[model samples]
Target: MAIIYPLQPRLSSTSTKIVIGLIWALAFSLAFPQCYYSVTQHYPPRTICMVNWPDDYGGKHHLTYQIAMIVLIYLLPLLVMLITYSLIGQTLWGSEIPGEASDHYQNQIQAKRKVVKMMIVVVMTFALCWLPYHIYFILGSFNKEIYMQTYIQQVYLAIFWLAMSSTMYNPIIYCCLNQRFRSGFRHAFSWFPFIKVSEEDKMELQHTQTFRMTRSYRTENTKSTVVRHNSTQHDDHTTVKLMKS
Candidate 1:
């Protein structure tokens, strides 16, 4: 949405909180029904409460939940990212920013390209990491015998590792690929003896805050101007009505 309307006023903190709260509530409710559906087994050294299957109808509940979640949580978000990033890529590459100076335009283009590239990498990582995990469960749900195979635990372990790696890579990708994020990261660890934060890093951090403040100021000014214009028109209309009477 920000990419679609960059000039529009951003959501306030209250609005952001409300959105976050609503999403959490909705997600919790969706997963609530199957949360308690599980089976427990006791191994020699450990007790495994095999939730999401074995306790209830695995095909009826677990498989359905798996498919639903795969669509809702994984595929839907991936599709959104792909689409939004594609549009953003087109927007960035399609034309020069109107009225921007040549050098500044090129700089802006380069920065935006880095961001888009980062997003694509992030999306690809997410898909690769989670796709197998989803597929594994779907397959196991359909054929329970697969879970009994000797290599099943190993495959599951590998898939779990890969899926978790997705969560850990985004920061690394941002730090490695983008100068701005790297700069901020360096500044964050500047207190450590081994970490060095340069003047440029400080500027990079400040630049983001400055840009946000400037954008907010412009939005407020625009709103105020509109309000004043409306007030002036109303005053003129009142004056005209009195004169006519």
Candidate 2:
């Protein structure tokens, strides 16, 4: 969206980049397993309480790791995204740019709304997909009995796939809702065997390109006009001085 839409926030500011880097580092550091002591050499039993521990460990560190993973990976990121998107949404819809017409402004607002809506959908999908996976860990961390149940392994497999499936949906979302991505997808598809790019696809890609070019020209033209007007006034003043002399 940032590539196609000029108005989209790119977060190119140095401070913002630094903050993002810090956040990513923190999340990554927190996600690493700190309780390697609790990890079994083999997988945990599907239906037994007969696990041998090297020491008289109470698995408190394991619970802490599980809680950290849930907070850092899922909850923390989700909260941050929600807040960021909310600010973006307010900026898009609340503020109006000068010289934009009512209809054009409305269209811009609608476009931003779509972008925000897409972000929200992505976040929600992630939450839903990963919910079961995290819930399993949370349950196991708090209740050893549930962790030792016969059906626990099967449940883990199910939630694991559910979480894994979220990664697959992002491309579909982009192709379906984003015009630039759709055009790019079509262009790429044209290279495949027995596939040809349609004229409409070509036109859509060209149209977006042309629109950007036109905007650049308009901005440059406005600056040129101001300079020309100042030059014209100076020329007139010189002519008057020559006539008076």
Candidate 3:
């Protein structure tokens, strides 16, 4: 959506909702198989929950699933983001937002630069956060000794926490980098005395709403004007034909 933000025929609320639902459904569906294949072993004191992975005599289901997940959930997304954001960055920096006043055009360009920078930071952060965990998973899968070391548990915990930290980084990035997001955050916590939500800051969100309404109104008005202009031309042609007859 952000990639083609300036384009026409954008997704409506209903379409967006359906897409969100489909994404969640696909994620859950893909995850269901792993859950089904998991095994719980009770070893007296501490029970271990693990995948029912195969060995020499068994099939390669677990290994295959792990590879698939690493590709689908990690590598593919990373690759896609890298490509799309690179294009977006190039477009943003290279192109000009024409027809605006000089100051307004400069401001828009700066805004685009900020947005691209923020998105790049987010992508890099996410990639870094998960790199160690994915590497550890791959190592452990191929080499059983990777999991046998004394410091292995500590290493796993650190990597797991790093991966989880990516989720926390995103909102903070948006709040710090985007004015509207910061404004919304301020509005949400207006009860706190220290966080002053000024009327200008409040207008940041309302401005978006007002802008959309105004743009739609302009579009409808243009369409009506075009229709009227064409109809008048047609009526003039009819009058000319009647006089000739």
Identify the candidate with maximal TM-score: 1
TM-score of each: 0.84, 0.64, 0.80
Give all candidates' CA lDDT scores: 0.85, 0.75, 0.84
Q: Of the pair 2 and 3, which is ahead by TM-score?
A: 3
lDDT per residue for candidate 2 within 1-245, as digits (tens), equals 44335544566699898999998988667644443333435345544324333432676765677788888778987898788777776766676567758896776667667766777788888889999988887787667788568987788789999998987888788777776677778898887887677787898789789988997887678779989999999999999999999
User: What lDDT would candidate 1 get against the real structure?
Assistant: 0.85
TM-score rank, highest first?
1, 3, 2
Over the stretch 213-233, how does candidate 1's per-residue lDDT look in tens digits? Answer: 997898789889999999999
The per-prediction tally of clashing pairs is: 0, 0, 0
Name the runs in model 2 displaced over 4 angstroms: 1-28, 38-57, 94-111, 212-245
Over the full model, what C-alpha lDDT does candidate 3 score relative to the true structure? 0.84
